[model samples]
Target: MHTTTPTVIITGASSGIGLAIAETFLAQGYNVVGNARNAARLEQTLAALNCGERFLAVAGDIAEPNTARQLVTHAVQRFGRIDVLVNNAGVFIAKPFIEYDQGDIAQLIATNLMGTVNASQAVAAQMIKQGSGRIVNVTASIALQPLQRVPSAIPILIKGGLNQLTRALALELAPHNIQVNAVAPGLIDTPMHTPETHEFLCGLQPAGRIGRPQEIADAVLHLSQAGFTSGAILPVDGGMSSGVW
Candidate 1:
């Protein structure tokens, strides 16, 4: 019988939704390995959580395939098996398509696209060997429903691909008993958003308020345990994707 607890690797885990997800999993007794580009910061924050030996911080550039390999290697070495991989690392930039610069485009592709791809590839191999696992992505709801005021085609373009990747990977990995899913969120009240923008952000959602990081964390937790569910993009978007507000 399997005696050890499940292990989860959460990318971009130093802050925002990623941090919340880490906290949630830790609270539930899952061994957590968190990744981020900032090593000191990642260690400082998560280590302070007093998770003892159960929490590990592997700091590296999320955009690199090496980083994803490092995460998988560390998780397997420390925890013995990988059960969940949360591709929660991403960058969202909003501006007119024409206004986007090369740097912006490159960063978006690196953080939002390649990070997920690399992490998924590395983790899937391990999970397939183990015969079971879960992969949950944190994509954006804006990819589905566009906002004229927020002409962020570049971010949507990459995030849109993730939504598709969720389905594609789910189909490809089903026989291995590995489920792939995504949580597409609307405006969330993270450190990414300043306090002054909260009121304005509230109006953008049918719920009349931005979502909390913990809310997204909750959605991810659900996907992590949902064995019968796959290829599903669960929108925790406060009705933004529901219809016209």
Candidate 2:
């Protein structure tokens, strides 16, 4: 590892695409601070990764601004400074719009929308102080190109806003030498998708198969290092953002 390699804070890093991002960054020798709501799960994840001192698991709800602030403090205190933040914490509720109850709507907003906002807002301030950083959000490609078979209006409504926000944040932070980008992924093979739904989920996209979490992780890593690439929402979903299937 270099003497001053990047230190990254990856929210929702206990599983799925977030986990992959954590592992990818650690493997590349970046100091990683992984956050999740469940403390026990985060401990298990830290133990399982066996990444030694390079990885730090900080448990917290990304939806809460206090948690976001704590994550930044832990990362900075442990690694000296923060270089990248992956706002990968989110929740997806897939059902008919009318079927969504108050709880469902609230959960979706708190996790998917507010979670990103909280983390990004807190991290952006730190980055501004440091004079450089990268913010990569894990959005959804299906939000831009909704599947008729999957009617998740509220979730899409939240993610679509994130897509636009990525652009807006990129422009806002560009002068500070901070890049904000996003990777909009399609259906991926993760614990989030059970085995039974794999086949059906595959058919929703033109890829004819599910994407791997590593693909999304790779996209995030690219954006983290791509100095000139800001505000661009790269689609990692196999043609899902192209058009209607």
Candidate 3:
């Protein structure tokens, strides 16, 4: 059915875990369509990856439905079809539950929850026609098991929603032969966390270390190629979701 190379669309691909995933896919010779708010940064990443023409960077806010549509459209137009969709675009803010305002709640819902929903809808429509596809969503470990050290109820709520969506979509799309899964990371060493904060964040994980971007990327890649695996929520965190140590 597919005459061209398999194509993957990765959101939040400007940096960190998303960027690492993009690079890994590109290295594997898959056509990568990366989306993010910064077109310049996406372009820079594309250049750094050095996978000319195999990579396309689409820049826009994932919170907007239009961006999701554009990403799917671009992937279809450039490549033959969408084989994989990585819903990695998200915003993380940790604070006391009561400290969150209406704006904070709205943003968390828009970017983390709604963004994945919109992108999944667009990609699933295309995948259904093709009769096969894979979706890997990136969520936070706090969504599975809360950490007393980090009181982030608002954002975790959004991530937790994605975890549920992964299972639901996997079943709903199973008949269509589409697979859906999620990867939850804990205290990943990304730009979001400062060097000074690493020491504190590492203590939360039982492994006593923060995860690398490639670690998450590797888990995503594993799920992408795992034919029999779906409705799975893989925790790439360093045993943070197991229990408090």
RMSD of each: 1.5, 1.5, 1.4
Candidate 3, residues 1-245, lDDT tens digits: the string is 23489899999998999999998998887999999988888888988888878888999988888999999888888887999999999989888998999998998999898889989999999999999999999998889999887999988878998999999999999999999999998889999999999888887778989999999999999999998999999998999899878
TM-score of each: 0.98, 0.97, 0.97
**What are the clashing pairs of model 3?**
none
Most accurate candidate by lDDT: 1
lDDT of 3: 0.91
Instruction: Compose the digit string of candidate 1's lDDT tens values, residues 132-187.
Output: 99999999999989888779999998999999999999999999999999999999
lDDT of prediction 2: 0.91
Per-residue lDDT, model 2, residue 99, is 92
Candidate 2 structure quality by residue, lDDT tens digits, 191-212: 9889999988888778899999
* Model 3 regions lying over 4 Å from their true place: 1-3
Q: What's the CA error at residue 124 for candidate 2, in Å?
A: 0.7
On a 0 to 100 scale, what is the lDDT of residue 163 in model 2?
Answer: 94
